[model samples]
Target: MNIQLLANVIGHEKGKKILINAFQNNKLSHSYILSGPKGIGKYLLAVEFSKTLLNNKSRQASPDLMVIQSTTENKKHSSININEIQELESFLRFTSANNSYRIGIVDGVEYMNYSAANALLKILEEPGNKTIIF
Candidate 1:
């Protein structure tokens, strides 16, 4: 499928290029890690990609296509918590609505705690067609 992720002026030029390349490739990685300096739209790229992927399927029927912010209150999702990771795992485990993709985005992964990072690693070890990270 030809997907459009318009990330211009978002500061993730390299990510935009990489995503374009991934879309062009037949073997799109099931998991990705987009890391760079802050305010570079790394998380924005992930959200855009998820939305693009959702366009191919029905967006109305699925609630699990959630954007997870791994943060505590105070408007800070700069840390990935263990509970949040567990929720992500649960979302991944469930059968998809209409049997299609359901994306989970964990923003600000650099602040992940040890427990959450370990949990994420487990998911990474077990491959799934529906998951992507940024």
Candidate 2:
């Protein structure tokens, strides 16, 4: 395992160890929830984990990586809608470029509306092969 990937993150030692262990053992789950208070490096940890899983230097450029976040429309309230969840489902349906894992990260999932939450749950219940969502 490459400890350097998570070297920059402050604190969260147990979380880091768990992620590394899962990667090393090939025991990663289909979904994971990193719940805690705000500004505790949850997003940073998730990004690092995604990078490690994808084995790519750039998460934004990786075809196997999909990141979903809440969108604020017209400066009103922020939300994750059903459309975003559906997009994730569609993304997972495709084959990976190199027979690798397809990783999806949903940031601020608490902002998802009821319909979106249900949609995401449906995907979680029937996640595709080699597809993981966090």
Candidate 3:
């Protein structure tokens, strides 16, 4: 697979190369943490990487892709909570269609509260086969 098609983001050549190498080499881990300052296209990279893993470009239409992000309710920013983590866990429990990878992308992970973080940690520790979380 061509790296350019996998992740379309400009810049972050190093990051894109790393992800493409992992995919080509079949050396993907169960979990990955993409940390950097905000507005650095981390989420975009993750989504594109997921598209490559799942062989699908339309993330919204893919059952194998799960994305968790902070929510805004009543003009207030709500941190990612344990319930969302639990939902992600449930989503990952199912078998991936076409036996492909079940990819989970958690954007704005820094907004997760303590309980939510712990829940996510549990998922990371015991991610099932063919499950990849970013």
Candidate 1 lDDT over 42-127, as tens digits, reads 77677666666666333353464756664554443446678888888888887667566767777767677789999988987885
Which model is ahead, 1 or 3, in terms of TM-score? 3
Of the candidates numbered 2 and 3, which has the greater lDDT value?
2
lDDT of each: 0.67, 0.84, 0.82
> What are the per-residue Cα lDDT tens digits for candidate 3 across 1-134?
64555446866788888877887898988988888877888888888878777777553668899999776433244478889999999999899987998988888777787898999999998999999998
Query: Candidate 2 — worst ten consecutive residues by lDDT sum?
Result: 69-78
| Full candidate order by lDDT, most accurate first | 2, 3, 1
TM-score, cand. 2: 0.89
Tell me how far candidate 2 lies from the true structure as C-alpha RMSD in angstroms: 2.4
Clashes of 3: 0
Poorest 10 consecutive residues of model 3 by lDDT?
A: 70-79
User: Candidate 2: deviation at residue 122, Å?
Assistant: 0.4
Which residue runs does candidate 1 get wrong by more than 4 Å?
1-11, 56-64, 72-79
